[model samples]
Target: MSLSLLTPLGHSNVAELIARRTLTAVFQPIVNFDGGTILGYEGLIRGPAGSALEAPGALFAQAAREGLSVALEHAAARTCVAAFASLGCEGKLFLNFSAEALVALGETRDRTVAWLNEHGLGVDRVVLELTEQCQIADVARFVTAVGALRESGIQFALDDYGTANASMNLWVRLQPDVVKIDRFFIDDIANDPLKFEAVRAMQHFAGASGARLVAEGIENAADLIVVRDMGIALGQGFFIGRPDARASREFAQGAREALDAGHIAVFPGATRTPVAASPSGGMAAAKMIVAAPAVPKSATNNDVLELFNRLPNLHAVAVVEHERPLALINRRSFMDRYALPYHRELFGKRPCMLFANASPVIIEKSMTVEQMAKLLASDDQRYLADGFVITDEERYVGLGTGESLVRAVTEVRIEAARYANPLTFLPGNIPISSHIARLVEHRAEFYACYVDLNHFKPFNDRYGYWQGDEVLKFAAAVLADVCDPTRDFLGHVGGDDFLVLFQSDDWLERAMRALRAVDTGALRFYADEDRAAGGIHGEDRRGNPAFFSFVTMAIGCVRVSPDTRGGLPYGSEEIASVAALAKHRAKQEASGFFVIDLDEGAAQLHLHEAPGAAMPQRASALS
Candidate 1:
């Protein structure tokens, strides 16, 4: 309810409600990001049913206006503690209170403690949330009071951080036990770098201050991964659980799957070159929607005509029934039909569905540009002319033109190609990293093969960079041919280096096949004399003469599985590092292939415990 709707006469109602003790409390669970468990519930208040002050916002607003904020907060605290105790909730109980309410609680400490004991809520299990709504005029006095409360085992949290009056100075002075990041910074943090950085900075601050960070408003899997990866311990949001009189004891299935899926979120990166025109993040359809006026299914053709006449630039009109879209009437088609002889007089009063395509394409606002592109390929191409209706949960919101969908899809396609290697047209570094991250996220069983050229520098020196490019192309083709495109990803990690994430069960055979192909193809790139001698003489980097063998491929394979044996989960960067080590080991072998089975503890032994002796560096293929 709006404050403008409240009157001085409502003062008596507020007093009467408080005197009768009619306040109720609901709880929303706070989840632990790392463990994927409920850490606690934040207690929230609601007023009497069907009243002007039914919402906490309106209730608190009225209380503040009447100078009864402290009294109301105290009564609300009692209600929340009683409700939580009655429900037999576990873990900590967070109760929100303004600075004034906190100071007042400190004055009545003994009485409040006794009151909480009566409701079976210990001071140890209660965490008072101090919002930055009002400034603490007396810092020293407030600190002393908070210190006394802390002595009584009452923890404190700073709410709605990173906005308004929640300043650095206040943080240092109060030194809260928990800091709740405001929704402004937490929303869409996965896509927005600025918000991500802000939360990261807060995470670091919390670490140093010995305080825990709670990311507020985490409503999606992408954002959840970003926050969880950032190491924030606690999260609260509608996606996690909505406020309820009896909140869920466990997380939702979607939240549980996302947290346990082991897939690392694919972070969006800025594309620098024209090779990739845009970033890889999905753009929601809502971004391009036009808020076109829609007509109900009951509307007549003349009504739609009037709407079209009123808005000269309107493309199409959506026919909705009970907020659900039924069809789309293209403006041109409708106008053309009305232009026929005596058509206006004959059918102008008829139902608009006469000209509407009943099978109009309707997409949710959350649909991505890439998803919409797939729809454009469908046999029914009328969406191009009729324009698709945008909806939220199947309820019509607006209209989106085919032109915008094509433009967005084109940009996304360009972005996907941005990381392609110019020499071989294979995916480049970013794509390689993204694919590896995806594999790790899905917990897929795959072999990460790091393919590099052995003794490549001598070939480049003898045959020149042009021939070196040919050798790289040949290697890329061999690897590509060995991969099952439907189950594998091949990427060119610059120069002569390639990475293949093979999901095919016969990855061993494929690796060996590529190696054998490289062995046969290596001779063709060499000079007649070098091919005959099986080697070439070149000056080493130390100025010493050396006999370098003909360029051959080295495949370092590391098997990553869902059942990895380690203290920590495998990350994309860690997998890359492990693969590089395996590649170095492969260079030492004549077979040109080496495998590190993580299940056999070979990775830990080689990468961590052992740290094997130094190996010789291969010559740069680019040089």
Candidate 2:
């Protein structure tokens, strides 16, 4: 009934409304795509019931006409702060600030500060959103004012960016902590290349500015997916949420989970790949540690015993102290003691800490499965009996079983070795194909660099197979040295051919670095006279001596974007065909350099070499 008074045409005096503080607040959640968590809520203002100025836009416009813009804005701010306090939000609050109000505050934000303090909200909890809708005449003064707020522990975000204030100049001058990409840029972004490019550029710009990017007005699941693929951390809009007065924390369906998983291969007619969680001995511990919330150390022995009995399938329950795992209580061990005479009467009421294994195997989520296994190797009995605790930054996140770790690490390591090249030991055909398929399923970005050693066979004919093997090993080491084990994949496609799957943002850098390292390392393999002469005499296919420059490396780089696929969406044969074409173009260069195929339409045609590469050396390293 009260909401009925907030009609767009409800007549009210703007000045009188400001004086009476007749306004209300609504909240919209700002979700974190990477973490699958509610990052914060953005508080929007509404006018009082039954006022012509009830609509927030109308209210602000009326106040500006009445020369009370600053007063009305402050009134709205106070109302939102009070409203947020009543609900007890768990995250930060993003509030929209008009240019007029900020200019009027000058260098003093006493009003906003006092309201924040009065509401028990920290300066860190407040983020003032400066939208481009309010043009700034003196950009410098605005920057200084925003800087002052930042110095006081308040954060600033450039709202409605990529529209009127899309200028690089504005971004440089304001240097906000976040850029909320205007909704138009995000609308239908999944199908629009221009919008995708714009957001992609902004992503790089955000990285350079040390600011995060938020995609606002994500109205659909498909658009939200594209926004996430472009690597925006914070997301908003009707799809993620709508403005609501009740401060509800719910978000749009499938958006949060899909974003956090960082992959969506919902291509029609595509079968789901085997997505295994070899979390142990892998990346963060949170990946593998199943969430069985820990029991406090102070929990009575009876509590632990009852938990064990209640959950018949339970293997163990960790005794945690302030989020840290202090001990473990195994079902079998506890039952054995409970079966003894008066065991319950003797220790049922005592703290579980006393009966718990004070030194139960504890493992952090950050530790690689390799690291956990190495640590577990110290105690064979414990490895078989008690599992490990997975902690994030020293706080328990979940539990890790030794059996799970062993199974995951052993399978991955053995599979890797089985398919590895006999000499280089880099992954071979099976692992390489599986890796690409898996990454395709997850919709990850990777650069597939197919490297072919030019003149390698000829060099072997002249220098013997053993010498050729030496050069191959040398090249492999150089490639391995450039790979970031944590984020990238390196494989040997047998002989003088190698494949690198780059998953990091700096993939181009790492790829270029590898190519450069190989070029330099190849030179060392040649004898002094050959290195200086820049050519070696080798027998060609015609059995005639040919002048071959020191072994050169040629790389064909294929960009596998999240939304990338050509004629054959999930076909391994198509990948090889495209790779062969890229390598053919790469080998055309006079000197060894890598070239990238940017066209998504024709994978077989129009492979373009990446710019900024060094001058091509004139030698058929493959000849």
Candidate 3:
């Protein structure tokens, strides 16, 4: 077992060494971050017994220097396949390859697949990981080779994506099924905003390109928390399991043992173990359960009014008969429909206004406090019930409360806030988009305004981000004040950009006035010296120096008309575009307000026309 004995003496000596079995392979498991399930293992090649080379990296490096890189790769593949056969683990096996070896051998992939098939390992179980340091010469050839292997069920993953140049472009073009982000990027993503932003951008890109992102080289629990919060679905790192042939079996066994013991095992170098709950706690131990509220389908409006009078804070009443659910009637709907004059005749009849879809959004009895919280965080207030009705196969079981759901959602919000931007305190783009879509469906005559701060970058560069941030907060407060929850909405769409939805046209004028007043008042933050010496202070993107002055915002407003008009007055996609155009026009004209005219055949027309002009005016104004 001396190191000198394993040295390759010559071609003949190496051939004899291969014949006599000189190398071995080690397997490491890659685990998912969310549930700690084993995704697969990377098969790391090692030196043979009695070899000068101590590890695979050294052995492969030496092999390449000796012009035997192709031979070494073939030997590694064979050794890895042989070792994989004995494990009987049903997961992918990742094998490494140098780009040079792939191009040089020219026909290595086909032969390797055939050899693997000859052994017990099939192409479906194999994953070829393109090594980080390899320089791909012929991308087309490499793609062709990998594509051929993939047709046989082999998968390709681009390793160390963030570490190399043009990696993103390569990934986009090759369209690999998986892209393993370099550990450097994942290590500090939780604390570093730039790193987190980069991960988010990469994740979005991967999703768009139909590729899965795998964060590799995670080393601790802290890192695991960051990746999971970032919503990464697949992960691989030393914190999960080290590279070893028995790692998967060890993980499976440990997981099963943990399940049986009703406890999870936490240790360094150990596979992930699930924390199982004891079955002894039954219905009596449940925190909250959905109970079918006693609602009569044949009850009159007076009956519902009596029920509400009895329970003034009623969230919703489920209309159910026997064990089956019929509909959900909320307090608001009852008031809106039955409180009208001449609506008394419909009182004794069944309420056709029930939301039957509410059943799908119901909470189950077995749901934990944590799970219940997430459902309520994004849920609408109108859907809240005094408690969720617990049911088993149409049989009414128990009840859950709005208070409990609120507590759960609060916890989820807190957990979500850990990763949310502190300045905006919004759920970022992913959750923000969902909120916008929900607002759109409300179908009100709401004005969605895209707010952009003019010359704010110059201010940031001249004064500092601290003051610039104050200005941003001031703008946010102004917008928030103008937005009425009962009639409007406000959202911070990242730096210096805000969105406000106004249900009332009067509020639009108020919002503009409030923003102007805030901007004017915020000017006092700067010193008297700098205030008087206002001029361009920073360079624009084109490298030209630009002047800095008082802050101003160009607001673009698009009215999302009610869908009841049969068809949209304007295309939804053109709303933001037209608003942006109007805002740009305002910016160019140095005007405080501008409106995007959505009227048909109004091209080249001014938004505000003179009295008695071609455009029609209000009949009251004419009088």
User: TM-score winner among the candidates?
Assistant: 1
Ranking by TM-score: 1, 2, 3
Instruction: State the lDDT of candidate 3 residue by residue for 145-204, as single tens digits.
Output: 666667777777788887755387778656778888888887755444445556767899
Q: Please give each candidate's TM-score.
A: 0.53, 0.44, 0.41
RMSD of each: 13.9, 18.1, 26.6
Best by lDDT: 1
Clashing pairs in 1: 262-441, 263-441, 264-441, 275-418, 276-418
Model 3, TM vs. native? 0.41
For each candidate, the alpha-carbon lDDT, in order, equals 0.78, 0.70, 0.59
What lDDT tens digits, residue by residue, belong to model 2 across residues 1-623?
01111223224487566546667899999998766788898888888777677787788788767666656666666677788988888798887776655655546666557657878998898887776766787877887777777777888788888777556777787777878899988888765544665677788889999988889888877677667655688898888788888877777666765565444322110111111112122353456686775799668989988788788877788888788888888778888988999999999999888767888777676565445546645645674677767777778777777677767666655544445566776666666676677677666666677788888887898789998999998888888788755446677777788877776678777767877787777787778888778878877889887888767788887776655544235444345445655676788877555456434414333233345444332222111
Count of steric clashes across candidates, in order: 5, 15, 23
Residue 193 C-alpha lDDT in model 1: 45
RMSD score of candidate 2 (Å): 18.1
Relative to the true structure, candidate 2 reaches a TM of 0.44
lDDT winner between candidates 2 and 3: 2
Tens-digit per-residue lDDT, 1-623, candidate 1: 01111123344656667767788899999999777889999998899989989999999898877877767777777778888999999999998887877876776677777777877888899999988694887777788878878888889999999887887777898899999999998898777644665676788888899999888887987777767766688999988888999966987777777676544443323211222213442445888899999999999999999999999999999999999999999999999989999999999999989888998888999776656778768998887777899998899899999888887877776765657676777777666776777666657678888899987877888789998899998998899899765457777778788888887778899999999999888898777878899799997878799998888899988889878865446767667767776787898888888888754434443445444655334322111
Instruction: In model 2, state the lDDT of residue 530.
Output: 83
